[model samples]
Target chain A: MSGVSEHVVIVGAGQGGLQAAMSLRTEGFTGRISLIGEEPGLPYQRPPLSKAYLKTGAADALTLRPAAFFEKHDITLVTGTRVDSIVRDTGHVLLGSKTLGYDHLILATGTRNLRPPIDGLEHALDLRTLEDAKRLRKELDRPRTCAVIGAGFIGLEFAAVARALGHKVTVAEAAQRPMARAVSSPIAARFAEMHLQMGTRLCFGQAVKEVDETGIHLPDGEKIDADLILLAAGVRPNVELAQAAGLPCDNGIVTDAQLQTADPAISALGDCAVFPDPRTGRLVRLESVQAATDHARTIAKRITHGTATPYAAVPWFWSDQSDLKLQIAGLAFPEDDCIECENGSVLRFDGDALTAAETINNPKVHMKARKILALQAPPGRDTLKRAGYDLTLI
Target chain B: MVKVTYIAHDGTETTLDGAEGDSVMATAISAGLDGIVGECGGSMMCATCHCYVDDAWSDRTGPRKDGEDDMLDCAADDVKDTSRLSCQIKLTAELDGLVVHLPSSQL
Candidate 1:
């Protein structure tokens, strides 16, 4: 380990995987970087798959990096290939039948959409990958009713686009409100109104008992006819390889502050890695581009510059639905107290400390919240209240 | 044509002539405003183009959509009565003198 190791192997060529490769080189590590993914073609951004890409069908805009960038960076991108196993003792990863050795291994396998146990699930379209998005986009070409199973970001986003395309859309949420797990009840209710105003049907607190060609059957026996069904429930980490290889895993592959697994030779990132949250010190998994890229940069710095600083990037996320843009800075638990400003900004607090800030179409506040959270001594609720909750003074 | 004024966080003001039906976000971006990233390209996906409408002209802007109001809930700064997603504010004859204030952060 005196000289920089020459070979680095990264699994999962999504946002984090590709960023790891690029950041490794940017950090001046002249190593043999290999990026592998099970998905076909080059790595692409998944965020747009549920929004713009679905509406415009612009497949080319979804790519994360052009193929030429990888070749120029000396990164070996092994697309359409999956890593079967990791042998920590040998410092090698097995892909199909071939085993490739590496000085350091990175797991950026990301996550897959979770499909609950429901009949005729095959009829439900998924918006996780490019292929799934493409298929769903093709479905939008025809005039048909759409039934979205979940009211999360992706589900609501797709529903908005579908409704804009003049397709009848109905959103079914098992929770009391849309995006109940992610945003506050007030925010969820507001979006409920938006969706309803757009002519998209909202069905809350209804569990889907079954999915059939005709439509979905709710627990109360109400059936909604739909030609297209989207399963936007949520996602699960792709930790099978790590679990099979004897790596510690929970909801996602567990990693330390440095994103390294229990085995020092292996590391994980993106939606696949579950690390401790700096704010609450709770183990959490994030599914945003900001987290993935930030994690990659942290890992790259540790590997190349020997910087062992813990991963403490402030988390933020955004979602687009019709005429509204929702941006969240920081993470708030379900029980966090929310204060609504006169301007409609919601400040979420865990005790006296601000846990997160939720803003719609207001980037200034979103950015301020991120900065405030990153500060050494953020303004407390009292300070914020005294300042008229300006956040600029903070 | 609709006239719009954008006031930066530092109190710098820039005026632009916007076509009718263009979103305030699009008008600002087209006018080369340094702020307003519009990351989601006006789809309301990213709250990068947030702004605060002037109190006098706030009534000219339409009420925020449900999704827009929900997004405003998680903004970094405290939401105010004048806060609005610039993208959702379209240029119209009635909004000729519409003025919006920029927030401190879009990061």
Candidate 2:
């Protein structure tokens, strides 16, 4: 604690940034913490935007903290403020005409929705931010027909909500199954069935060619009429700022296992930072609330305790679609093979070693997966099979 | 703001003013209290904000909703008759001074 200066300036006041500020204070760091956010309000949670907020439209409930909490914690929260550049030479960040110095800088810029190259793309809306969600909610108010371009979590979640609200919803996905990139095939198929049962149409392996004011046109010369269109294809990290600042960025702002950039003074986390996975050693970028908050806590400990511990928290993610709550603990790569347990839980393996477990409405297995992955020696395929994939016995 | 008392498992009580609309878990977390994590940020996805409504105040807190009732089974600590995920319990003027005991741990 005595080794550094007084101020810790954080860019991107998303979940990770706010958690970093809180963790710094909780760790007994009496430094001047300045949390800069581009959005014009208190930092709020993003996961609910696609699920509960869409159904309830309670925007205020998403707020992570009240304005009074920041003031009481002595944390300076600058809303609607964008940090233009990082003046590394001066150890400061440029906010237009003004500059703020930092003893250490944390970048949690997060990500933006990936806008695909579809004609009349302007007709589509996003659900990444509060503003985006508000606009999407407005569209849901009318007796509307929705065309969701992606079968990912956001698109599917929105489709489910729309279906629940008695709206005609059609989800067009280029992939074979919903959430295929995140969940295993069987799990994704199960969710696809859930959406289908709820009367949401799913167009699989169909690339949307264009989006007009009326609806979306598939590449197969077929068109679906929709009053509202949502583009939840995917997201790209906001790495331009870090790249402009001369930090190495691959899929995201590349950092070491400890989340430290090439420059020792700077660190990055959340959807924006690609760090080495403690289990697989693969450079991975996670966009979950769990990853963001965990990375923040790890960085805070290193800053406060002055101990250089590598970031190693098990990554977890959750997606709520209709009544099915899908939870996955540990990181699963595209190449990892998946095994369906007797209890219908999908256990992913990077070769023989258990990498991740995907559970449908099974929190116990998901929790056990997290605990197992956090261990020094996680169970291998043999051990898992011997225990009948119960995880508890292992 | 609605007044609420959060009693830690060790019997450490911290009373704070929770906004009229915010949940009991959010209030405890916003105050930087140790017991509740609220990891999912009131999403009800993670049961990290589990707390036991004091028997005296349990009736006022109402019954647990469907999602919350099922999620409590996954709570880090043992579930009780009055146990609830604080995220589901929104603070209201009528429930001012409501007491909820925090579990030993919220994963």
Candidate 3:
């Protein structure tokens, strides 16, 4: 609690874990930093796995830091090692019979693909980790019919790539529109149109009943012949380790504004952290690189500099489908009002206040929207409407 | 192999070797050079990989890739006329000794 927190142990060395290790050094903390990951390699970026890596099959592009870099930073890199449990009272984590002591612990366990109760669901592939992506790429070697369940970001991104690779892709979604939870109706409609034009069959309002040797079947008794079955329905946070340690677990590992868990010695971040939305004060778990890195920075600063500032970085995410780049700045609720912009962008408002902005093939507006949303008081819907929803003018 | 010299904002220099087809950003990143973040992993989504091509080698790096300038607006530092996303600048035999200046920070 005085100088620098000594011996910081970070669990789940993906984006957030690696970032915390690096950030602690950047913040001038010369403590023992150990990053533990279940994966066998150095931490890599997950965003490109469903996009570029699937196409180019370049694994190096996904790696965040090389092996030598870890040595240079003095951060202990442990891969293919799992921490079996967390001993909160003893300030140590248990890995089988071995125990690692820590002045502070960061949980970045992230999430795993949700496996529904569909018969033969084990036959479907996942796209969560680098290993999963590599497997998906191997399946792409041949021209095959692919059945992608769920119409979220991963499913659609994979569908676009499979369709572009000359593979027959049929996307089945239970919702009426694609990406219904993330984007508004207008943007979702546009994406649906884009994928349809590329010859990817879109089956809306259809739930996959089962996955067998013949492919996935709808409850209506429609069977699609798919050689490759992909399950990108969504993900559930990996909270078992924390939950077993007596930490509260809801939709995710519950954390306060500073990303600190119930025990001050422990913290959570990234896909596994359920923190309050900086703007809306609603508990949420976000799965994005921005959230992962920002949360890591905040936690590192607290450990090193002892800064008590709350974690409040603006939330932003992007999905690339073929030639289209869809970027969303800030968060919007399902009940928010949607307004179309002149430059083909879309804005969401919770009453008079601006909630989020969505753009396609427009990073400029997305950047501007992120800056605007980060303000102490973001522009309201009335102000945006007065400016004709032109972010540049504001 | 092509060699690259990356000068940090505070005059720290890091020289690293890159494969013929590797991007300059990929080269610096693989070496853990402090300046370039490449948060998007060379996907061109985030401009955290922003770097300035040395004045002498600006023309050789040539124009920015399509949509590169637009993404630069979100860069941590101000964009320079020689601004180029390091990921977009691929290493080649002809340009073996490329010098790129890194910004103060990338977030």
lDDT of each: 0.84, 0.89, 0.91
Q: What is the iRMSD of the candidate numbered 2?
A: 3.8
**RMSD from true fold, candidate 3:** 1.3
Compose the digit string of candidate 3's lDDT tens values, residues A69-174: 8999899999999999998888999987889999999999999999988999988999999989998899899999999999999999999999999999999998
User: Per-residue CA lDDT of candidate 1, range A1-394, in tens?
Assistant: 1346678899999889988987898789987999998989988778888887887787865665667667777899998998989888889989878999988899998988899998889888888989998888878888989999999999999999999999999989898899988999878878899999999999999878899988999998899999899999999999999999899999999999988899877889989999999877799999888788889989888888766789988888888899787888899999999998776778999888988999876766777787789887888888888877767556
Model 2, runs deviating above 4 Å: B1-3, B8-22, B27-35, B45-47, B52-84, B88-97, B103-107
Q: Model 2: what is its DockQ?
A: 0.32
Where is model 3 more than 4 Å wrong at Cα?
Answer: A1-3
The CAPRI class of candidate 3 is medium
Native-vs-model 3 lDDT?
0.91
- For model 1, residues B48-101, the per-residue Cα lDDT tens digits are 688888988887796886567655765656678888888888888998878889
Clashing pairs in 3: none
Q: Per-prediction DockQ, in order?
A: 0.06, 0.32, 0.70
Estimate the Cα RMSD of every predicted model relative to the unseen true structure.
Answer: 8.3, 2.9, 1.3
Best by TM-score: 3
Query: Candidate 2, residues B15-35: lDDT per residue as tens digits?
Result: 999898888887787766777
Better of 2 and 3 by DockQ: 3
Docking class of 2: acceptable
Query: Each candidate's TM vs. the true structure?
Result: 0.80, 0.92, 0.98
Rate residue B2 of model 2 by lDDT.
89
Across A119-180, the per-residue lDDT of candidate 2 in tens digits comes to: 99999998899999999888888899999999999999899999999999999999988898
